[model samples]
Target chain A: MARIVGSIMSTHVPSIAGAMSRHAEGEPYWKPFFDGYEPVRAWLDEVRPDVAVVVHNDHGLNFFLDKMPTFAVGCAPQYLHADEGWGIPEVEPFPGDPQLSWHLVESLIGEEFDLTTCQEMLVDHAVTNPMQLCWPDPDDRAAIRIVPVTVNTVMFPYPSARRCYALGEAIGRAITSYDAEEDLKVVLMGTGGLSHQLEGRRAGFINKEFDLRFLESLTEEPAWATQYSGEDLVRLTGSQGVELLMWLTARAALLGGARKVTSNYHIPISNTAAGTVVLEPAA
Target chain B: MGTGTTRHEIPGTTIFDGAEAQKGYALNKMCFSFNDGTNRAAFLDDEEAYCHRYGLSDDQTKAIRDRDVLRLLELGGHPYYLAKFAGIFRLDVQDLGALQTGLSKEEFQARLVAAGR
Candidate 1:
């Protein structure tokens, strides 16, 4: 049977790509953010997950307004990164775990959560940046395969925190029940926010109070955030900041309560509040 | 609540719901095209023609021509797709933030950093 080793909730701000491309991690402005990953890298070295189930939202790189699905899973053998029109150099393609993706799709649908399954999907910065953050070395990245699970955070009418949590539970059920030849170690990755908006007059909005509380809730009281409505989340976290739904879903995927391993928070990572948290299932 | 029935207002923010989507379709369509280098180059070559091809509303066209970030949002532009449009002019989110808030880039950045403390 396959098993989830742990889960990672991270910020996928696009500008982080430029900072990395310039190798500016040691620069004064980016040092704090980069330094946060040290412990995360150490944890990864210890756990050594064979596959990563990345839960993120696409930022206009794959699905568009033409047709949007509330939830989509990629079953492609290879997922490529493309130009986001912002001139950030595209990263290498991610090798996909199609078998696990299909298993997730079948189990999730069986669990009554309808999802769109794609055999071809273009991964945007949201997927690419965090992958790079986790495995800074290409060789380390090569060892792990990926299964991309995207939620509709780019537009309004988003799935509720509670609904996303339930989806995560279904994902956990699927992964735990997956019958495979070898025992597979999987890491659940939730990539997005910690309060920051980028539109209207509140373009640079960052709610530290809400972010800290939300971060605390992830482990201390996992479902604490599900109490708020989508509008409430946007009002409290900012438009793009509401991307924390990704965090909730990933956290919920841990069958048992989670134990916080390491966490980091910083402001104004390219008009967004950037954060990262690692949680392993409680023993 | 996940139910999509009710609507609530968030000051200084526009929820890109169904109505906003309908209103900004053409403008966002044009912006989404920027994901391709050739389309970005074509838009740079003739902004008006590209806007015309996308059937952008006169207001949206003027907003795009003026590079008015706030006006584009008012005209129903989503930040995600509008970002690609901003890319054509080499504007990052910080630049967009400054423009929308009527602050200098440095001032806007300072405001963000201050949010942490």
Candidate 2:
């Protein structure tokens, strides 16, 4: 049976990629951010998860406003680079694990989690930025398989934090029920958040305290984390707080009482808290 | 070739009024800012300066500028951003037109929902 070896929650600020590229050699603005993820990079190296089920939100890529699915799972063999304006820089197209993705989708729906499946989809920075950051490619790195899941946080009346959490629990159940005989270790990665507004006069505001508390709740008391509605979150932490649902979902997928392996928090990441936390099942 | 007279006589010709055009400009500006690292950095450095440079109003300069989205739908009618805007506002497609195009919102949403959008 497939087992979830661990879960990771990381903020998907597009600048993270820019930071990594700049910091790989060493740049001032991004050095601190890159430093924070070193431990996370080490953990990923040590665990060496076979597949990563990434949960993120698309910024109008794939299922644009015409029809936004609350949760869409990628069942495609490969996903193309989205022309999200200027487009991605020097990155290879992402490879998808359709078999495992479909299995998880079927298993989740069978477990009562309604999932919208996509055969062809393009992923935006939300998925790519974190992937580039967490798994910086080696000289001849083996490709890492991905199962991309999207949440509807881009639109209003988005699924509540509770719903995302429930989906995560369902994902955990789905993975647990997989009939595969291989020693599959999957990593549940939640990308997006720790407080920065993307719109209006309050656009560049950052709530450091709220971000810290959110990271605390995410690791120590995730159940309490889902009580906040999107509106409540926006009011407290600006509209970007909506991304917190991704973290809650990651938390829900973990085995209860997992040990947090690495936690890092940095502020003013181009006007946001670039926070990350990795949790692993208790040994 | 189509006659200029017929094109000029098209109804809703004034749909792209000054306000509507401004909204489209704002939306494009935001899209540009999102795409360009230098622009985004300048905007982050000083929002007021960025707005002044872009020639956008204070309301037009907000971070999550959905008004521009609404305006783009009104003027140009790009389904891509409209769909996203509709999803963002949770506004039914039909209702969006009825509200902006003088159609009944319910009927518009119904048509869109029926069309599988």
Cα RMSD of all models vs. native, in order, equals 1.9, 14.2
Top model number, lDDT? 1
Q: Which candidate should be chosen as best, given TM-score against the real structure? A: 1
Per-residue lDDT of model 1, residues B1-117, tens digit only: 223556777788888888788889999988999999999999989999999999999999999999988989989899999999998889888988999999999999999989888
TM-score of each: 0.98, 0.72
Cα deviation at B93, candidate 2, in Å, is 29
Model 1, runs deviating above 4 Å: B1-6
lDDT of 2 by residue, A1-283 (tens): 7899899888877556555665552566566677777898898888787888999988766664446688999999877764454333535677788889989888888877778899998887788888877888832123677889999875555788888888998888888777777988899999988876543323344567677777777656877767876666777666665688888888899857678888887664544667788998767
Q: Residues A1-283, candidate 1: write the lDDT tens digits.
A: 8999999999998888899989999988889898889999999999999999999999989999988999999999989999999888898899999999999999999999989999999999889999999998888887889999999987778999999989998999999999978889999999999898888998888999999999999887999999988989999999988889999989999976889999998876787788989999998
What TM-score does model 2 score on chain A?
0.94
In candidate 2, position B5 carries an lDDT of 23
Name the best candidate (by DockQ): 1
For all the predictions, what are the DockQ values?
Answer: 0.81, 0.05
- Looking at model 1 chain A, which ten-residue stretch has the lowest summed lDDT? A265-274
Task: For all candidates in order, state the fraction of native interface contacts they contain.
Answer: 0.82, 0.06
